[model samples]
Target: MSYVSRNKFESARKHIQEESGNLDVLGPENRSWWRQKSKNKQFNQSNSSMTVETVKQLTKVFCDDEALINKKLPKELILRIFSYLDVVSLCRCAQVSKAWNVLALDGSNWQRIDLFDFQKDVEGPIIENISRRCGGFLRQLSLRGCQSIADGSMKTLAALCPNVEDLNLNGCKKITDSTCQALAKHCVKIQKLNLDSCAAITDLSLKALSDGCPQLTHINISWCGNVTENGVEALARGCPKLKSFISKGCRQITSKAVVCLARFCEGLEVVNLLGCNNLRDEAVQVLAEKCNKLHYLCLSGCSQLTDTSLISLAQQCPYLSTLEVAGCSQFTDAGFQALARSCRYLEKMDLDECVLITDATLIHLAMGCPRIEYLTLSHCELITDEGIRHLSMSPCAAENLTVLELDNCPLITDASLEHLTSCHNLQRVELYDCQLITRVGIRRLRSHLTNIKVHAYFAPVTPPPSAGGSRQRYCRCCIIL
Candidate 1:
């Protein structure tokens, strides 16, 4: 160990000796062994706490002392810190004092600005101030959830953040195709962009993005109702490096878009099409064939998809780990069986509202996907005590399993809760809307699984009769663990 590590080890040993409390039990040999062990552990944790303490001290010294606060901070450090601070915090810091205001408003420090929830009426002032403060150093900008950000505001931002790489205008209700045109003209280096939930954006905006941001890797246009397969095809043609794409709730996109993505963007790892109600088994087949590197896939609310798509996914994508087919009501026992058999390395699976699934599927899942850690079966009406019992008795039951959600599964009872007590590593369990689960079951779980977080929503408990025979005493409990 170096000198610094050795000193840290000595300090840790002293701390352990002071805190051990049973000094009388330490024999010469035992004491020597513990001292050596403590030294090793302390060396591993060397200077981490000290570094944190130093940063805290520096922040306090800089923020408190008037003389130092007036002195200009290193331009590089100011820009670095400003990039991390959100727009609200940046604006607040500018009001600290005259010197800080100047530093905060400096052109070099305004690299990435996030005006997410800035005032609606002050859009003009906000844009003017930002443009004046950040001459050309602005690179990344996000105006997510900003209701006041119109086409003009977007144009100003695009003009200012010239070298912009990432742009997010998610839920910017006022922005239209014109905004995209301005962005294409100004921000040529845009890579990761999110126009999610922007209803006004159409194929025109997508065309601009494809034409301008050729190096784009990640794009999220989820809930943009006007974007269709044409837009997606255009994107696939222009941006070959696109890896992560989320078009969830985009009902206009069809299997054609999926095929285009598979044929063009071979490097995709994350794709979320949740609530794309039009997608069918053919889309999944295309994805499985082309996007073999995919790790995360969300087909939630794709009601048209059946077991065929899931079976194809399991057979084709060997690296598949996280799968969310929530609200895919057509999935049956056969789908789960195929998933269990082929996708053995599955880590997280959400089968919420898959009513056809039962104990047999759960048993197969437990036996096959031994590495499964997170499972959600919310609203799975077919899931009963048998399924819960089988899951609780699986090899993954004792350990590894950390999160489990069984909300609205009425068949789950106190017995299932008792079975879960053996899962010592279980961190979070949601039993919301499981009417059969009572306080007794919760108390029993707490007894064995001391560290586990448990959530139980009780709605069936009867109210006690009032003494005055006027009103009944109601008791509702929602425990979050």
Candidate 2:
């Protein structure tokens, strides 16, 4: 026996003797309870003395049994604890033990599985396993950025998970129309479907969605090259509850499709037709007259659209908050003035590359849309310091404005930076390639505007010519100038 164990046993015996005043009862039968319970099978008559080794073994056995009881958690307790963990945490918990693995992969905990965190690691086999575990019970599933998964995984989900409502398959490049067909055939309750950047999806998939998924309210088929006017028109005709439709790069869609959408989907609040060049003012006019609930609109790169569309939209869509006309070069200040006059709820406005807008547009916007929080005027060379002065003086600019982007505006000078010093809510300022703006002005602005980050792009300086006329140029410098 060790010295510590011997001393502990002797001290315990002495303390018991002093406190109880009953040394006669501390015999073999009373000292060793396990031996008494076992009918004296563990002891021998030749060695009845209480040895230190015997004390250590009995103490260890009792402690081990008590710890085992404390370590085991009740099934009800583990279930309640697992309810708070997300899908990723539950998946990680499955590695702890067989009991934990059974509870983590239970159907109740997997009703809404968001695979966004483990998208890179989740392939067909992993999805198949999830489908089998959560069959007929899963409601919402987000497989966003799961590029490694293909049609087989989706097919299994469609076959088993019938109650799926919100499914985000964003950037899943290998998915074809077959997966769409399966979803349309079974998942009738699907409300939100994101097929964004699903390159293989064609008009046939949209047709299937129209025929099967009529409950879809938010659908994003942006950059789906094969989706044309016919598919979008069919979808609008079928899905009357559609509120948000994003088809940014569908070049085949024309003004006719927009008119169909305005006529059918009257509850539409958000529409992004960026790069849909075939859409003209006539289509937008129809939308403004019909879609009264429109709140977000983006017509960037729609070169054919004129000021008439903005005027009509502002007059009709009273709840308009976010508007982007970035590549619409034809729109002048007259159209903007009309928009600013009516859309007082405008929160975010983007007028990138609109060269016609000058100080008058900014003044009108500042006076009319006081709630403007994000403003982008990149490459609008006509805007000068006078425009920024009007914006900084506006009531909302000091409290609401968070992001201000003035990239490549050559006419803007240090005076513009001085005006922005008063905008306390401004968080990000982008001043790329404005040659007139000096670093001293920007530093002064930063001192006044706390928690503000400035992003400026400076031109590269050419090194002095060598004696033989060999010109050397430094790498392009990007800093406040």
Deviation in Å, model 2, residue 470 alpha carbon: 7.6
Model 1: lowest-lDDT 10 consecutive positions: 472-481
Candidate 1 regions exceeding 4 Å error are 1-102, 117-122, 460-481
Task: Give the Cα RMSD of candidate 2.
Answer: 9.1
TM-scores for all candidates? 0.76, 0.83
lDDT of 1 by residue, 190-210 (tens): 888898878999998888878
Candidate 2: the clashing residue pairs are none
TM-score of 1: 0.76
- On the 0 to 100 scale, the lDDT of residue 412 in model 1 is 88
